[model samples]
Target chain A: MTPDPHRAHVPAVVHLDHVTRRFGDVVALDDVSLAVGPGELVGLLGPNGAGKSTLLSLVAGLRRPDAGTVRLLGGDPRDPRSRTGLGVTPQETGLPATLRVQEVVDFVGGHFPDPVPTPELLDQLGLGELARRQTGALSGGQKRRLAVALALVGRPRVLLLDEPTTGLDVGARQALWDAIREYHGAGGTVLLTSHYLEEVQALAERVVVVDRGAVRADDTLDAVLRRVSLRRVVLTAVEDLAGRPGVVRAEGAGDGTPARQTLYTPDADALVRDLVTTGVEFHDLEIRGASLEEAFAEMVAPEGAAR
Target chain B: MTAPTTAPTTPPATAPPLPAARLAWLHLRYQVLETVRVPIAVLGNLLFPALAMFFFVVPQREVAGDPVVATTAVAGLALFAVCSASLFTYGLGVAEDRQLPFDPFVRSLPVGAAPQLLARIGTGAAFAVLGVLPLVAIGAFLTEASVTLVRLVAGVGTLVLASVPFVLLGMAVGYSLSAKAALPVVQVLLFPLAFAGGLFLPPQLFPAWLDAVSQATPTRAARDLLVQALTGEPGSAWAWPVLTGWIALLAVLAVVAYRRDEGRRFR
Candidate 1:
């Protein structure tokens, strides 16, 4: 099997071409293609089981795609040499309970050609105090911090982190984010997946929204946010204006009595103009920009409809 | 403590990859440490054969005093110890590790599985040696079991070599089944195979039909070889061939089970 010729020209640190993965009858990833360039931080945003983990696994060489090729550092992912420059933190990792924090770090770091010292790695992750503690004794947040720390020990060229801060508190999450930012700043490519909209918004320069085993949108974070740039118009109206022009969706207590109706539209001004021209009786009208959460919800709504 | 916002400078010189021996030793050290911390696990493997010697061999005057009988009895028990260690350590240990999240992390490392498996086998062998110690002491002090230094050395060698099949069998069970199922399966297979192989009773005591059947089992082959080494007797003609065949079969099974498990979980 030959390497994908076009991928060589693109300087991608991680590349997948028409990758499809299935478990029995369920398609986990369907004809998905992605390329992450050197030093790029790409956030994979999706709900649970949205093929986010599957995609990361494929690139990490932890899983093989049912069809298509996965390349890491211009080498086939299945080769151990290809993983020499790769580091991954799966969604859940069970550290050896009996090994002290420092020993575990040292053991894993020893495998890499250029690994950060154990103490330095621990200090960077705010885990220095717990270095002597057995991993089984550490709290959930502390363990999460250590897991992320292990991913950085190798000073990998590209890091794959799956919900690195899932169980962390606000303070721990911030600390982890700082550590991640520092690594990325050092010219490391990173692909991270998260269900937390704020985490991606706060960290990712590029966003890939996945749902129902396919990429719904992939572009710069600002571009994706712009693509979902819809305003929500909420008001108490006496008539059902759900089918009004320019209104993408409208729902409320449409009982013919005056009740609050929330309408989603690409152009709130046009919806309001249409409402006014029709002489609809309304009150307490308010318009607000859609949040990233709302945009994410709209992106994945098709999956719900298919069900 | 607050974390450093700035990334540290890269090390001036990258360290070379550690030798496989060093990695295997490191793995062995940690595995031993972990098992030792759970003192009961160590005690269990150590005491079972020792207690069996004290109760079964120590009181039998006819068998305890005769050099040939005592030596054979002690050698058989030592092989029993190796079998137990091989079965429980790899079987239960691998099954338990499969349940842990840590196993995946180790599996994903650049270092291949050989070192880890070697370390595990080394750990089991170390425990197997420990398991035989009490029996050796009891045989030396309480019973009149005696052997030449060369015989003792050869007997130990035989014990270690004979453990290969059981170890592979353990791995096969561990990788093929869940911990819940593997535990009982190891236990269920252990005692019956031990009895049929004449680990507890002498093969001479078995009926002709049972003794003929026992000759084909790995356990029986192990016992025959160890006894031959210890007592300077000619082992059954079938012993070497039977053990070699079992080792070959179990090795293939172990590899298949390992690949199947890896495909199911990691792939």
Candidate 2:
């Protein structure tokens, strides 16, 4: 396939080529290859231990892949210079308890060539009111906000956040999402990992679902959402519904007073038409699109069942 | 949706990379600030050696009255100070840091590890020097520990040089173990080393076999060198070589431990 001319000039902000990482004998990442172009906001969605953190760690230069290459900002991720324009907040960050919030921001900022001023960065994160407070004194949500503030202090062109809002309350999560949106709106590339499907749905233009150390799907948010758009048809039926046309699976009582059955299908309308044509008596029909949670579960189900 | 798409808010004017020395200094400043905020830690590090002097040497009239003996005794305590600071600062401190998530964040920064390590050494040295002051005052006041300006300067220099092995050893322990294990390990290692090295009693009082074995340890070499610098008394022929050997060995061990820890934790 020819490279699209319009995209040829913009190098990928992150490139992982058949990368594999292992801890002892356990594979944390299995030959995962991904490329995120500049200005793309990609969400890495996965359950715990599904290699989300491992991927971010590789990009952040905190760990090396056992095989293949990881390039950040067009250079080897392991090099300090390669990470100079990158920022990361790991899943959990403990700030120095004795240092005031502002001092921590300044200290981290000092390492960058051009850093956002501490006050302005803190203000953006809604942490200005607590800038002078010792980090240990702040609530968990506040600490999380401060950690994110530190990540942005360098005015990084690419940001990698691993479960950035894991401990945050709803209000705090919203605020952090707003801040992240503003950054992405300003053309910053963001690759964030999250177990919260809603968070990813709200922020990511592209979604990569990872399961069992591999990417199950990587596409635009709408594409991924559509991939899991299967409908559930619930009804009471006297007939054996398992082999019905268009039904992926059906489970419930085949015979009972108002016999209950739930059939899963890619096309609920076609399945309903088939039931009608076959003259299968049914009642209490309900058809609904799968929730993102169900889509995520269905996506990761094979790995779960294999284990 | 057509927001003015000006060139992505240009980053603030890029400042030149801070010099390594300046970065190291900033780390030193923060390290000192963090430690000092806990007054008890500072007091504990400073008071132990001084208290040891007050109880051990001041009451021994014959030893205190003799300039050479008193100077050597004070020098031994000073060596003890440096050893304690090195052991606790790097040993316990490093292990504690390893448990904190903040450490990984700092380690991942673009500035590399040089500044952090140098800052650690600087902080340890500062504390070591500070911890010795009370012992020095006690020696000068309660005993006849007389030394020329040159001897005093050389003595201080010797104390710092002697701390290298202990500092590296502390780092080795810290990086290889958890905070809970490291604390007890440092405690277990420190006292035995101090006692065998003649910090508590003179090497002349050691049994023949004990004295022979003591000469092989870094602590003993440090104590011997400190006494030599303070009293102008010659140390054993093996002192410098033994110290150098221990420094080399500990340096290798420290590097291995650090790399192993990094591999295990970050990887």
Q: Pick the candidate with the highest DockQ.
A: 2
> TM-score of each model's B chain?
0.87, 0.88
Over A1-307, each residue of candidate 2 has an lDDT whose tens digit, in order, gives 1112135576777889899998887899999988888788999999999999889878877777889999887877666677767777733457888888888888888887667878777776778899899988989888888887877777777888888888688998888887788788888889999998888989998899998899898888887777677788889877778798777656665464556777778898999998899888988899888776885687786642421
Q: Write the per-residue lDDT of candidate 1 for residues A1-307, one digit (tens) a residue.
A: 1123254565788888999999888899999988888778899999998999889877877677889999887777665567767777733458887778998888888777667878877886778999999888988888888888778777777888889888778998998888788788877788999999889978899889998799988888887776677798999988888888888766675686898888878899998898898888899999999876876687677742421
lDDT of 2 by residue, B99-176 (tens): 887776776667655577678878888888888888888999899989988988898888888888888899999989
Which docking band does candidate 1 fall into?
A: acceptable
Point out where model 1 deviates above 4 Å: A1-8, A90-93, A233-263, A274-291, A303-307, B1-19, B207-209, B263-267
Candidate 2 error regions (>4 Å)? A1-10, A90-93, A234-263, A278-289, A303-307, B1-18, B207-209, B263-267
Query: For each candidate, what's the DockQ?
Result: 0.32, 0.32
The model with the greatest lDDT is 2
Model 1 C-alpha lDDT versus the unseen true structure: 0.81
Best candidate (score: TM-score):
2
Model 1 C-alpha lDDT per residue in residues B167-246, reported as the tens digit of each score: 88999999888788889999999998999999888888999999989998999999999999888899899999999999
